[model samples]
Target: MDKENYTAWDSAEFLTDDDIIIEYLKAALEENDPAFFMKAIGNVARSKGMSTIAQETHLGRPSLYKALSGERDPRIGTVMKVLAALGIQLTIAPRQA
Candidate 1:
């Protein structure tokens, strides 16, 4: 099935609070769930505007889809590039209980 055929809610609801979204994303990273990470990336991309992100990262739309959707394993640098393109700043925090 095409990814575009699904809505954001299909995987997770759209997180309205940016801070909460970031925190949830941080926790997901800590858990190391590739699917969760991909979902977070997709949510961020959807919230931030995929086309604009693609343009800013100098990546084609299909490339963005593959990377963010986990169809391909992108390098850490590439993931950072995409996050930067989406105007999101990543920060590390001590593991939480």
Candidate 2:
């Protein structure tokens, strides 16, 4: 069966708030998948305007696009810079094992 048309899903459309972004990223990170983390970051970036984040991070818009494109593995330093640009800080805590 062929469907006429379907709208593509965009996580960014649903991730609009900063707090939500933080929680979403945290949960996604818990999965321990780099791709998921990258996608989550990309969603927040889209919500916040990639250009604005790029400027704040001193990164080129195209580079940001590629880094957060959900395919490439972004360097930890790059991720930290992006988080800082978003006015968020990353913290480490022991996971209950």
Candidate 3:
């Protein structure tokens, strides 16, 4: 099945554990630390399936693997591409700390 064919259930009528988890990860990525951002995204990619996510971002599976595996730091454009593909939005706000 194509990953793009799958839709995230944000609706109250059909929320799944995965949906909640994804939301948490998305929220956590809002932290000030870049490491937190990377880890959150990596975790989500693993749960969502790397190959499917790669296809969604139009990035190659090998490239996604390298980025998420921490072997390399993805460029800002790459990070934005993956986040957008995963339906994650990053927002800036005042630091809680």
What residue runs in model 2 are displaced by over 4 Å at the alpha carbon? Answer: 1-3
Question: What is candidate 3's lDDT per residue for 1-97, written digit by digit as tens?
Answer: 6556666753322323666766766566667566666766766776667788888889998888778654567798888888787776667878677
**Model 3 misses residue 77 by how many Å?**
1.1
Supply candidate 2's per-residue lDDT for 35.
Answer: 89
Clash count per candidate: 0, 0, 0
Please tell me which predicted candidate would have the highest lDDT against the true structure: 2
Ranking by lDDT: 2, 1, 3
Specify the poorest-scoring 10-residue window by lDDT in model 1: 6-15
- Residues 14-67, model 1: lDDT tens digits: 566677668767777777887668667876776777788889889887878777
Using TM-score as the measure, which candidate wins? Answer: 2
TM-score, prediction 3: 0.64
Ranked candidates, highest TM-score first: 2, 1, 3
**Per-candidate TM vs. native?**
0.70, 0.89, 0.64
Worst 10 residues of 3 by lDDT: 9-18
Candidate 2 lDDT over 8-92, as tens digits, reads 9988898878778888988989999888788788879888999999999999999998998879988999999998988888888
lDDT of each: 0.74, 0.88, 0.70
lDDT-better candidate, 2 vs 3:
2
Error of 2 at 68 (Å): 1.0
Return the clash pairs for model 1, or none. none
Residue-level error in angstroms, candidate 2, position 42 = 1.1
